[model samples]
Target: MARKKIVFVIVEGPSDQDALELLLNKIFDRDRVFVHVTYGDITSRAGNTPANILKKVQAEVGKYAKNNHFEKSHFKEVIHIIDTDGTYVSEDRVIEDETVGKTIYSPDSITARDKQSIVERNLSKRKNVDKLQATPLIWGKIPYSVYYMSCNLDHVLYNKQNSSDEEKENDSFEFARKYKSDTDGFKRFISESDFSVGGDYQSSWEYIKEGKHSLERHTNLGLCFPDSER
Candidate 1:
């Protein structure tokens, strides 16, 4: 049997694509899942715009579909992931469980908050919500693969009080802090939560990783991976 080809387009940088590739290669099994990932201007402030991202995605998808001998019908089934850091205020907050979600900045790093607490603080609650369940957003013909974290590379993950190199390797928090502190670093995150087009890359990648093909109003989602029985 021939493997299915899925095209993934990210806004910019390699992180979004790297994360998806990790998940695909490790969790989804690469043998049956053929993937082509493209990195556009996901990291840049200008390229993160919804219109620009969508335009690039459409062009790439169209090109691949034609090259792969896929017609409009098959192209309709192709999934697109346009990652964002969720820098927008609207997308950053979602009222779930009577709590408003927001991003908070620490001395060394920034992390997302569900109401007053960090997302990690409510890991138990995260289990209740299906991790894979996607929400179709009003970005374009594509739904996003959203991972709106509070911290970018600029934010320190480990020690907010101290930003020494010794503290970084011990914990992820410190590492985040170092990245954020760097000059023109990718520490500041954006996504559907926030309005910055620059932060939309990760969510976009997540969209394609889950095999979501956005067409017109109605979306083609819940397409299960070959190994995972949905």
Candidate 2:
């Protein structure tokens, strides 16, 4: 029998790996893809950054080709999934209100300048990876993509859209947690959700870039699986 094509993916955490695993199962044959989670915290090590992930991917591809005595084309795709958390602004940034004699800051808040800086920094990182001939699927913030599927896992699984913003913010983790015990349930929820309604890869990429799917949902999962059955 012919060997199945391999598509490699690197993600930040186990939850991300699980979610992408489920998604890839839908897009390709179950045994065709491999998802690796770095569990690297971006604050210190640039966890799952495009360049870092691609380095590992290159090593893996090299090893695989050497073992199989085949060319790199034996692999179908090599992709990275990164989260845009503190990349937008330093988490240490804070403002002092002299009038009130207090410090005011929210983890979720980003100034216009900070936003621009973050975007530029991320783009530069991506360009560095592209120079290495690998592209990544970046998720703006942590839960934005999960939010695109529904307000939260409760909303996606139970049709309950009443989750608070805080709950919604952590929905990706919650969904990943649930996926561990109930993989089928999560798969079922995904099958019935409208997460892929924005046409094909390029269209969805444009939608996310234009901030239609939430300014935070700036991911390229669509591009990673351009021909995926949606």
Candidate 3:
């Protein structure tokens, strides 16, 4: 039998991977599914530039391939998922709150102890996301796409945007468990949810950029798994 090619999924954090890893594997049964957790938001991290974003992705994919001794050709496609994190919101929507230690993302505003940090982070993240969206290939070969979960995976999946770390893990674990044996149900949950964005890929990206919509419950993840059933 021929070895199964890979469908590499790039995600922002462990929680994101924890939530969707099993479901994705079930959905892409014919292909090996690998979820590469970025640990942090790569786009908003310091020293990451729009110019080198794809290279960063290349490095991640390369690490996986190298350890497995699998060539790049072993992959079928790359699907990158990122949290919008209110990145497209206006500056005024980033409100400074003395009591808020970590940034709190609401539907219309981002409340942070350090508002400027959020503002600057949003600007840089938006630029890098645009760069990613504009690029159709990773490392000049693999087919690639970037999808959004705004203001983040927590918000879109659980309707809880400001969850603590413990809550996040519990929520993700439960969500994964709920749909682990019901991948089709998971597909319907994502595609038919109120937060699901309509239209083609490009238009979905465009939709997330308007006003404070990026801070709301919205996702284009359905675009990744058309005809998902086996």
Candidate 4:
């Protein structure tokens, strides 16, 4: 049988690109799959979204194509991994606002409560800090997954195995892996937390911890970050 074609991913940062690349590698055996994932600095400190991100993607791909002498057809398909925070003040709400900061309880205070509770509370505050809008039609051709999550930069970069200072200093892939891992944690944290004003944090926490299906969902999605899948 013919080998499957490789996929190209254009991401917001070098790290973002790496994370997905890692996931693909982990899920698919190296011998069976091949992927070329690259990233460009699509962020402006201004914020990123589908509309604005595509511009960056085009420019980066153009540069890569020019330097490598490759055509768009060289790859099976292109996937633009972008963060969709939802809502917008401009084209595609793909970007984020840096000037604002939402004050949620510190992680230290929340750690004493429950992990799931902390996740929901922080995620709830994401809207206040940044406008996250999920947009389709990024590449104008290829299908992609534009992840829309609450702005949790610290978790995104800090809580994963790939996030060691040593890894970050040495390889860009390590940094990206950490960020991707955080995305998984964030998802799990929120899904388990009861966003309802009076919901019990403890109950939700137990459901996430003891419930087989719930834990599996989190791990499956969480493992989406991938370690060696590359």
- The CA lDDT of each predicted structure is 0.32, 0.43, 0.90, 0.35
User: CA RMSD for every model?
Assistant: 14.8, 9.0, 1.9, 12.0
Model 2 residue 57 lDDT score: 46
* TM-score on alpha carbons, each prediction: 0.34, 0.47, 0.96, 0.40
User: Quick one: best lDDT, which candidate?
Assistant: 3
- The per-prediction tally of clashing pairs is 59, 0, 0, 15
Candidates 2 and 3, the one with greater TM-score: 3
Candidate 1 — which residues are off by over 4 angstroms? 2-11, 30-40, 43-53, 66-86, 89-230
Full candidate order by TM-score, most accurate first? 3, 2, 4, 1
Better of 3 and 4 by lDDT: 3
Per-residue lDDT of 61-82 in model 1, one digit per residue for the tens? Answer: 5676678776543321233332
The best candidate by TM-score is 3
lDDT string for model 2 (63-161, tens) is: 655776756555665555554332333333322233532222233333333444445544554344333322332221111111122212233333334
The candidate, 2 or 4, that scores higher on TM-score is 2
Candidate 2: lDDT of 146? 15
Question: Alpha carbon lDDT of residue 87, candidate 3?
Answer: 97
How much is the lDDT of residue 160 in candidate 1? 36
Residues 10-98, candidate 4: write the lDDT tens digits. Answer: 55544444444555444443322233344322332234443455565556556666776766555444444333221111222122234
